[model samples]
Target: MSGTFSALNAATTALWAQRRALDVAGQNIANVNTEGYSRQRADMQAIGGSAVPAFYSTSDGIGGGVSVEQVTRIRDAFLEGRGHTEHANYARLSTEAGALEQVETAFREPGDQGIQSLLADVWDGWEAVTNGPDTDATRAQVLQQMEALVGGLHFASASLKAQWNQTRENLTVLVDDVNAAAASIADLNQAIQRGNQTSLPVNSLVDQRDLLVMKLADQAGASVRHGKDGMVDVIVGGVTLVGGTSATKLAVAGSLDLAGTGTSPVRVVTAVGGHTVRPDGTAAGQLAAMNGIFPSYQSDLDALAKDFADAVNGVHTTGAYDKLGNPGIDVFESADGSPINASNIRVAFDDPALIAASGLPGAANTDSSKADEIAQLRSKAGGPDATYRRLVVQLGVEAAVANRGVQIQQVITTQIDASRESVAGVNLDEEMTNMLSYQHAYAAAGRLVSTIDEMLDVLINRTGRVGL
Candidate 1:
């Protein structure tokens, strides 16, 4: 009788275990399409023999049954880490490539509307003056073309400055995003810690935290580390942004003044400790462009403007005279004698009669030597045009390199993500198969329980019916 009862109990336990496994499989199937969800499995363990007195012992020993041990989520920590690193690299390169492409558009190289074309037109106007220097018409054309050249330079400089300003605005927004993500991660950390303390399954909370950390990494090049009790720490530039349930905000500091001539290095600092963060993600790319690439281009443009002005003024001031018979005043001068640059360059002479078209003051109306000299500057080897071409080439090369980096990192990131998904992501087909398997086992266990009950019924009701 005892053995029969034990068999019934064991069959009941097996049924419960199989049902729980089926429940786990159903859960996996239901969340198959859920993002960041890791598939869970029910762990089963065989129950050993129960203690019994020697008088009650029957056969050798009867095992209790199977019982559920625990449910666990499948995940690969190493693959997840690699995926995060590759995502950061991809974001950085893509950001830089995008910014450079914008700058290249602003330049408008090899087009009639660009500075290179305008400079060529200015030289052609000077050549026209050499053809008929005494004519007001020729001098007027030269003045018009020079004005266009100055305007073109100013436009290019303004465009670059505008890009810089936009980048600063983007950085501010990204800082806010980073802070928000960090705070959310910290909150999730607290929840996970509490769940862990109670021995509750916190897989969903962990997934949410990991997603937030990945977002933070892309936004600010942040790094992550896990701690005991299911806590996570997020770091940016070696400074902790989140530790356990506490998060530190980020702030952007620096002048976004584009009107200034010098470079203003932007800094990202933690709100609590004021430690600077040299970001690694998209923000890092934008900051590099704003402080390094764009500024270098602007400086080059300024130098070209100054050199071009000096070269033209050097010849004009020594050669011809204005209508008042005075030595030609500087052809290009700032309101102050400060060095000429793209932003402040302008046509110095407002009147066409002020143009110097000859080498001798008395020959200003007829001699074309000075105008010829100025026009010949177009062919100078190290002139403004050549310098500008070099700038364009450099920009193209940098943009290409950034684009290549984006491509390579994207491939690497994709591969790593696939690997992670293989380990953690739910597969509907696999879950369905597991579901069928658990269902069959449950049916078998139920049948065993029914059979054991019938045997007990026979022992209790039929064995004692001698007359029947």
Candidate 2:
């Protein structure tokens, strides 16, 4: 009787174990299409051996039941962290390339009506003025071409500089996102640690934390470490970024000195919620944009402005009777005594007196030399129009390259994500198979229970008694 009951108990345990397995399989199937769902697996262990009568135990040992251990989500923290870093690098390169492209577009060089063409036309006008020195029409044509030359410069310079500033502003917004991501990562990290201590599955927190790390990396590159104590540590350039479950926020700070002369790199301090974080690699997309594009574009603009001023002044000083016939007055004067920026260039020539007086000869007081000065303007600075044309072409090329970079990165990121999903993602077909296997095992256990009852029924009624 005891042996029969023991068989029944063993069957019951097998049934319970299979039922649990079926439930878990059902859960996997239900969540198969869920985004960010890590595949779960159940751990099984055997219960301790059962006790039996001494005589029966001597002949055969009792079997132990199955026990459920842990159900864990399958994932690798290392791969997740690496995905984040790569995302940041991709973003950085793409952004820098984008801003540079915009800067390049400002100049439509080598075109028929570009700055180079304007210079040629202006020179042509000067030659005509040279032949007809007293024609009002010739002088007027010279003035019109001069305005065209300045107008193009104004348009190109202003457009490029504005684009540059816009990119910088975009960096500020990306930094805010970075800070918020970091904070959320830290919070999730702490929650996960606590959950681990209490023997609870940190599934939801892990998902949230991993997502944030990916986002943070996209904004700024940082590597993540999942510590044994259940805390997450983030590092950048080998410095502790988020110290063991504690978040450090990042922000965009510091004006572009455009004049910093230090090798230590004038850092843009990133502060968060009133707390400051030590800045790391400008490797992330937004920081890279700020680091590379703005400096180069601003320098180029400065160079162009200075060269424009010098070239015009050089030609004016060489020709006689080009000044407004006034003995001591110079042609151009800024309140700041510097060459005009994109903002101030148009304003610099707001007065026609400045434009009319910008001729040769300190006190010529004669329009006769205007034709001679126009002739000289071409001879002196006319050939250098190629320089401006080259600048515009470079901008267009850079923009094209940037666009290519973005496309390449998009492909790369997609491939990596697909690879990762293959390992960690749940599949409904597999889960359904597991459910069926467990369900069959459960039915087998039920059959054992039915068989045990039938044996007992036979013994109780048929074996003991027809006479009663």
Candidate 3:
């Protein structure tokens, strides 16, 4: 009887263990297409025989059947950490490349509609005026060309300012997103830690938390440190953005306007402490574009405008005369006499007769030397045209470098993701195979239980009623 009961007990445990394994396999199959889901495994261990010897207990060499020890999530911590780093790097380069492309579009270089071509038209107009000093049509054409050049500069400056303001606004929105994600992660941490304390299944909670953390990495190059009770701390620029169940919000502080960037600059800081976070992902890319990339180009454009006005004015105001023979004043000036820049540069007057087309005193209609000198300024080494060309070349090189960086990093990120998927991602075929194995085990255990019942029936009713 004892032997039969023991066999029945072993069969029962086997059935339960196999059932648990089948449930785990089913779970894996169910979530095969789910993102961020790690494959799970059920660990089985054979129940051992009694260790102590007792007078009432018989010595049985056979051990009890299997029991499930625990279910485990299949994840490689090292791979996950590397994944975070690579993802952050990829996001940074991608953001920078996108920003550079926008800047290039604003310049519109290497095309007929760009500032370079407009500048050439202005120079050509001056040469035309020099050739026909007394022709009112040629003088009017020069004024029109000058106006076109100023318009180009103004448009370029406005585009840059618009891009700067838009990027700043995007940074603010991104910080808000980061704060929301952090708070959600903190909430997840609390749930996960509590589940861990109670020995409850918290794999789903962990998966959610990991997804949020990866998002933070993309947004701010955040890193993670494992904490007790299955909790993780999120770090950005050496500061803890989230610890245990508490999250720290981030804020952007700096120039609201592009013109004020030189004085105020842009920075990401903790909302409470105002401590700066020098991030490296998308946020860092935006900061670079706002504080360095756009501003550098804008500054160069302004300098070109000022240099252009100064060079032409220098020639027009000295040793030159207009049709009326009055000394030539500045040909370009701001509305209120403010320092000239790309945004404020304009033609000083609209009258064609006011144009200084001659170099000799009181001989404006005869000598064309002043107009010729201003036209020749286009070929000067340190002139506006040369400066603009350099600026365009620099932008092209930087943009190319940024794009190439994105391509290279993309390859690396893909490789790492593949490696991670191999370990954590679900495999339907494998799960199906496991399901078959568990099914057979369960069937065999059921058969053993039936066999045990037959033996018990023979030992009890048949053995006692043989004579009847």
lDDT of 1 by residue, 137-188 (tens): 9889989999898888888889998998998899999999888888899899
Query: Clashes in each model (backbone N, CA, C under 3 Å)?
Result: 0, 11, 0
Which numbered prediction scores highest in lDDT against the true structure?
3
User: What does candidate 3's lDDT look like per residue over 1-468, in tens digits?
Assistant: 677788899999999999999999999988888888899999999998887868878559687878998899999999999998999899989988888898888878888879999999999999999889988898999999999999999999999999999999999999999999999999999999999899899999998888888898888998999989999999987889999999998999988888888998999998998999998789988999898888888998889899999999999999788988877889999866789999999999999988898877784357888999999999999898898889899999999999999999999999999999999999888999999999999999999999988888898879988887
Between prediction 1 and prediction 3, the one with superior TM-score is 3
lDDT of 2 by residue, 19-65 (tens): 88787777777778777777777777766553545753642365666
Give the backbone clash total of model 2. Answer: 11
Q: Which window of ten consecutive residues has the lowest lDDT sum in model 3?
A: 357-366
Give the TM-score comparing model 1 with the true structure, all chains together: 0.92
Could you say which candidate leads in TM-score? 3
**Model 2 lDDT-worst window of ten:** 258-267
A best-first ranking of the candidates according to their TM-score comes to 3, 1, 2
Residue 143 lDDT in candidate 3: 96
In model 2, the Cα lDDT at residue 315 comes to: 47
* Candidate 3 runs further than 4 Å off: 58-61, 465-468
